[model samples]
Target: MYQKITVQTKTEVKPQTTAHLAQTMTLLNMGNGEVEEEIQKNLAENPALELDEINRCAMCGSEIAFGVLCKNCMNNQLKQDSQYLTFVSTREFPVSEEAADNEDYFEDGTVDRQTLPEYVLRQVGMELDDREKMVAASILTQLDDDGFVDVDILELASYHHIPISSVERVKGLIQHADPVGVGSKDAREALLVQVDELKRSKDIPEWTEKVISDHFHALLKKQFSEIAQQCEITINQVEKIANFITENLNPYPARSNWGDVRNPQENEMLQLGAPDIILSFFENNPQKPIMIEVFQPANSNLTLNASYHAALKTVDKETKMKMREDLEKASLFIKCLQQRTNTILRMAQVLVEIQEKYIREGDRYLKPITRAEIAKKLSVHESTISRAVSSKTIQLPNRKVYPLSVFFDRSLQIRTEIKEIVEKEKEPLNDQEIVTKLEKKGMHIARRTVAKYRDMEGILPAYQRKEKVKTK
Candidate 1:
């Protein structure tokens, strides 16, 4: 068993250059943007690379060197497109009964809505004498979106150099404000304040009101039978009382009424075009006939001068070696830049072919796609796919295009078949209706799940889509 054994093998491997090693190290260290910056820097230093210009319109057969579109052709295209659709003014219209009702409600002053601080100040102003307005204002300012003051009354009093009793009195005043239940130091107090308001309005019976005011924890935990036994009321009565309490309570009472309305300054138009990469997609065969015109170093006017070479020949050995090293580095950098551009172009072409449906049909047709899928198709790593897509955009026939990254989204619970059913329905389907329809179609789904998918698609809730009939 202990007999001697010998194994012989021969292998050959190519030695990597210092420049190649340096490039590997650089690529490992830098991100996509940094790599792009490095490439541009190399191109500038080399004086060898040049980005080719697209001189003709692919569509109209016209010369358009400086820009992608010819002036005459662009104008004609715009004119033809303009005839298909008309732009509308942003004037207010009575589009829905609910909207009309909302208009009438505001006109009749039925709903008393106020800004957070204003509402707080009104109640505090009423309760507090002129002496404590500053303390009340300070307390109101400290209250957060949930209407709960983060700082303790004593802490606020210490900061303001006011008596703790004054802080408490001001807090009580804010707690009694309209949109009932604001400036409470805690959730318990907020809920109690709301229950008290409901009690005053006689929204619930005396026994049910007591249960809500006292045993809020039991109600929250859905301990309806226990609450009913304690309050000597039916389970049904407890449920009704709980609903009334929920309806009355303002979870974020100190939050401004105008919270739903966005400020115009916040609105921004997302520009979706990459001017750097000149891409052209051929209409007939998009799969194989796409062109990515990258900068070619050979096209540049740079050449090794005869005088410089003659001078170098007469120079010292050290000087000649230095010049050679610089030339080699410059040449290597230009090569690396070209390689990077080629990689990006290859990735883009693959993406266009795979996601052609999204480009042709629009956003509604966008399916659940991923970088992994593209990487597999392109014979590259997932990281490479991510790098290729990052900060890169494509120009399409319809408009200036965005990165292919924008097209890929997570798949919704609503399958393609379910979506088709919803779309083909004569009437708009609410979450519940959609859920019911899905169940009939043998797709097991909950109402909440349906609602979530609708939300993901940016579709509104059933109540929002409901329309009123016109009556004479």
Candidate 2:
């Protein structure tokens, strides 16, 4: 088509490869803390980018320096919590307490933010039998942070060349220990275990156990009539049982109740760093929508220095060219930062929409969602979603922090549901039976896989659970 090649001049656009590659790596891997550090480093090195004086508090979202909360926030906190009064009396209420007290603080100012395994190991110690100590330690280590058991009991037995009963016995011991439901096979099993512990007082509805045991789906669906009919009870009795389950059950037992949690100021901090995202629930609100507040680090407020952009017009040829290149690099860096945030936000919104049930109820309703599936839905590359999720932590309504990557953990969600099904089976569902049940619930997996998940969850198979029931 271009026959007149002699006079034609084409200027091709070439990307700054080194700068782009470095910028991409930074944007994808860094969480808010790292981003802030990078921003500070860039401001020092690159003459083009400058930090706009943000007259705002990063935490309270009021006006102050980027690093600390405003004076008003500090004063209001003093009026509310009497504990801070003594400290405030000695000195003027600084943006925060002095560095002397920083060591006394941990997450929520009460417990260390160690993973579930770490807590369990410390809590259990030398109490277990020597043989049991090893198996118990192994199981606790293999468990996910959520406290759902992840090692297959049978496999562990085979590997250790111990009887299956020894493994099962240790598994039961851990399950019954403090943080009562931590060692459960799944959310359902966790709920059941918690109920068993609570049932000791005998205040729980008599038929509530039956409903949870045999008619879990019906109860969940609010199918009172079906459950009532199956359990030979009136709908009124079913409602009472439903009320019991509603009041007592917790699907995600791993986290503290961020709801009604009153961690004192300075005391309320997460152990690692401030959260990148905050989710607040309004129990009083009519619509019942979660309010998501994304907190960007102070360094995200970078802009091109106006003097440099204006300097390009007045400077000499060589100097102007260099200034123009600097401006371009600055612009590229800002673009990468914005793109990172936008991708994270879009993914988070979609995840919230999909997991609203879980947010309202607890982890029990967390459906099986995968990064690949979300990547497809968002029309972005899986790697992009992965990068956006990397090293990120989210604050829940009750102010509990969780990794952004948690939304993509489908196996944990499935195992949680499976544990529920096995515990609720009228006559314990064997591995094969559980597989059939799981398929009905839209989780298609091999019988062996079902068995494996069951064993990993530390749940005894159908026959063993049945024997226990007969003994009970």
Candidate 3:
């Protein structure tokens, strides 16, 4: 008499895929020491996995010690720059033999340094209620070392099971923190924040924010006239605002001072073992192929236990099943390691291409590169580039140890370039003249940029410099 309807639902099961992804993310964020520790743990847990003696080089991919370039690659490199690319393990922790024997670690564990996020949270806590504190904490965890908002406000709200408006509200409030541009997602946003702060104190020119917000790229590219026309302002006004930004605002933050990136006690980067990837460039080659090498420590050399595999055939069904599962887990772990190597290699290859000038010439030539640019070029997410470079270091031919973040540093490098130009000049070059010289060298800097950099150097203007020279 009564009709009923049947309802059906399908549940998707992807345990293997999900587990692979979870492990991959874990490996991606791991530093060299952590990876070695993980490999040791895997060997201990998985009966089918065995540690092997690594006979081949992880660097330069040859049959030799992986710490330095093999003889064959070394000779090839010598023919070009005559500089052998060497990668060595650096101690990330300050521990003596006695400290090592004792359970007590380095002072880094108990250091008191106010990280940017911690500083921000305390400020937010002073103003916000209990509910807002929760949202602010979530936001704090996602910030990069330079104090930029690393996640989308909407996505964060959705993920945290909070309203979108709540996230946006806190984001706006956080952007007003002391650094002026601390919570920005990118350069324009940071500059805009600075501009806004200035506007609140004094009436900035109406077109100032417009030029900074819209034509920042053009500004970076040194298209001053274009920015002037677009903003419907005079070139002189553009020069004034440009000078203001250079003088009054920070274009980039020193990440080392940021609490999250540095050791809380030392306020420096973590020292780690051999670089994950070593890049040896063929300076002579027109295409400039770089040899990307992975450092293979003894602990990281993992292989399948052949003895265990052979024993599988003679075991009972339950034991054989268990062996197969362990084998699968070991294989999954190995695959994650292989993928990690490939991802690191690709990231290093991109770095070599982008920082070729820095590698071939000196630190002066290191361009203003960003993870976004690298991600765009590599067709990966920006987060991937960030994770790949987070705790890594690249050893250059000059025998200098530089963190991967050095490639992304623009302001300090540009200041160095300006100082070099002034030192090399026969006479004191005026700010306008310095700008021209920098333009010729592909810097495209504004005249205000020269004045700002010179002032930071505590060097006088052209007239003052000339007067001092005459007296000398």
Point out where model 2 deviates above 4 Å: 1-22, 55-273, 282-286, 312-316, 422-429, 439-442, 460-472
Instruction: Mark the regions of model 1 whose C-alpha exceeds 4 Å error after superposition.
Output: 1-40, 43-270, 275-314, 363-367, 410-428, 435-450, 467-472
Better of 2 and 3 by lDDT: 3
Q: Put down candidate 3 lDDT per residue, 296-382, tens digits, no spaces.
A: 334555667888899998999999999999988988887777556556665666677677777777767778877788877766656
What are the per-residue Cα lDDT tens digits for candidate 2 across 329-363?
Answer: 78888767655665666666777778877766676
Q: What are the C-alpha RMSDs, in order, of all predicted structures? A: 20.2, 19.1, 11.7
Query: Best-fitting candidate, measured by lDDT?
Result: 3
Estimate, for each residue in 281-396, the C-alpha lDDT of model 1 and write its tens digit: 44334453333332212222123333445566787999888767666665565444433444554555555566556555555456666767776766654544544554444444
True-vs-predicted CA distance for residue 350, candidate 3, Å: 3.3
> Number of the top candidate by TM-score?
3
**Residue ranges of candidate 3 with Cα displaced over 4 Å:** 1-16, 54-146, 153-183, 186-274, 277-292, 310-322, 410-413, 424-442, 446-472
Task: Estimate TM-scores for all models.
Answer: 0.40, 0.49, 0.57
